[model samples]
Target: MSKSLLLLFVAVFCINCSSDNKESDTPPTEEPLYFPPLTGTTWKTKSVESLDWNKAAVQPLLDYLKLKNTKGFIILVNGQIVMENYFNGHDAATNWYWASAGKTLTSAMTGIAQQENLININNKVSQYIGTGWTSTPIDKENLITCKNLLTMTSGLNDATDDVTPSALTYTADAGTRWAYHNVYVKLQDVVAAASRQTWSAYFNTKLRDKIGMDGSWFASGNNSVYYSTTRSMARFGLLMYNKGKWNDDVILNESYFNEATNTSQNINLGYGYLWWLNGKASYHLPQSQASFQGSIIPTGPNDMFMALGKNDQKIYIVPSKKMVVIRMGEAADNVNLALSDFDKTLWTKISALYQ
Candidate 1:
């Protein structure tokens, strides 16, 4: 070959190598999160094929949900709907009760109240509501802080749902015991007293309206339960999944959000500020003092946190997967206050979709 032709060939090979290097070095862009408008029925969605998820697993999961009497079920990925279904005479507009899953809502409201300087969670409950709130002796009663109520460490009786002063008798000194009780509802009273606004009023203005959720708290016997459309529950989960942010708005601060979703007390590693955490070493159940070993849901992602309610209403948030799952319905099998065998089995079905 001529010298000029040999030199020309070498130059072309180097240029080709350089081009390939540049292409490989560039990072892949992440998909942006989708946030639905604050006042609209329209919501964006992605299909199973687009996500490269197991399309074959979708029907089986839906079948199981219907068999177990699910009223509504939704799964979101990056704030977009991936799956949504309603069963047993329920529809998109049908409202269902959140049961104990609503406790997480109260937790978020308390955090907001603290951020607003209306109340400090560290302060004694009696400070806002005044003394004699509980029948416990003055010294013991003062030991109960707003944080205790959030953590279920109030050390109050869990036997009765009644929060009347007489029924809120002391089982042990506050902070030393962990028993789920209706006493957490008192935090609403504390917020109302401090903010000088009705609990529902404050909740509506600060949270519901901000996130475009439509829900109302109602008095059922001695409990205050929140009822809302399944999509509304998904919205709340999306906010929490974003670490208390809604698009451009900072709803709940990140500091409080981290504390609320992690271990809040020593007794139950799986229990947070009314949130049930997965992948904890151990956990305690409502009305039971014994500790159960292992993660709350073995098949669930380790990083997932949940708002689980009586009869299996749930809002599951998985940060690692950028996913939010909502389930609202009657008991899957047997009546349960919170965690049940259904959780493990349901997670197994959920895992099939992405695994």
Candidate 2:
């Protein structure tokens, strides 16, 4: 072959290789996060086919949810509803109780109060509500901080759900032990005292209203449970998925949000600031002192975190997938609080959709 012709052929090959490299180096465009309107029933949705998800797997998931007694179920991707279903006489307009999952709401509100200088989580709980709030001795009680309460490491007894002074007996030194106790509700009183506003009022002005969430705290026995439509719970999960931001608004600082989702203490690696974390090396359960080895949900994404409640209410947020899943209704199987066998089975089914 002629030298000039050979040189031209080599030049063409080099150009083609360079173009291929450029295409491979460029990052894929990500979908922008969506925020639904503040009012009306309107919400943006994406079809499973559009996302290239397993359409065949979708029905099985819905069937399992209904069979397990889920009244409302929603799956959001980048804040857009992808799958929503209602079962057993429930609909989008129906409100369901959040049970212990409502603890995440209190955690977020506490962070807001701290950012406004109304309270500091590191400070003793007694500092805001004054002493004698618990039956623990003065020095022992003083050792408990709002942060400890948020992490469920207040070392308080979990024998009773009651938070009255007479019932809040001590179990161990603050921060030295971890137990899932309803004593975290005292953080509500702390915020109320510090901000000089009722817990609901402060929550409305700072978090709920700002995010366009529709919900109200109601008295259930000794606990202040939150009841909201399924979509409202998804809204809160979306906010957390974005690290406490709604559109351009900074509702809670990113730093606090990170702390609230990650492990808050060494004792329970699977728990955060009222949030249940997955992918941890070890974890502790609601009423058990035994430390179990392995992630909270092995089938779930490593970055997933959850707001789990009594009777199977769940808000599962997976940052790796930019997905927020919500489920509300009675117990899926046997009546239980927070984590259950349902989680493992549910994730196994959910993994099929995106795997």
Each candidate structure's count of clashing pairs: 0, 0
Best by TM-score: 1
Residue pair clashes in candidate 1: none
Tens digit of per-residue lDDT, candidate 2, span 1-355: 9999999999999999999999999999987999998788888999999989999999899999999999999999999999999999999999999999999999999999999999999999999999999999999999999999999999888899899999999899999999999999999999999999999999999988887889899988778999999999999999999999999899999999999999999999999999999999999998999999999999899899999999999999999998999999999998586888899999999989988
- Best by the lDDT measure: 1
Query: Lowest-lDDT window of 10 residues in candidate 1?
Result: 330-339
- Clashing residue pairs in candidate 2, if any? none
Reference-based TM-score, model 2? 0.93
lDDT of 1 by residue, 61-132 (tens): 999999999999999999999999999999999999999999999999999999999999999999999999
Q: Rate the local accuracy (lDDT) of all candidates.
A: 0.95, 0.94
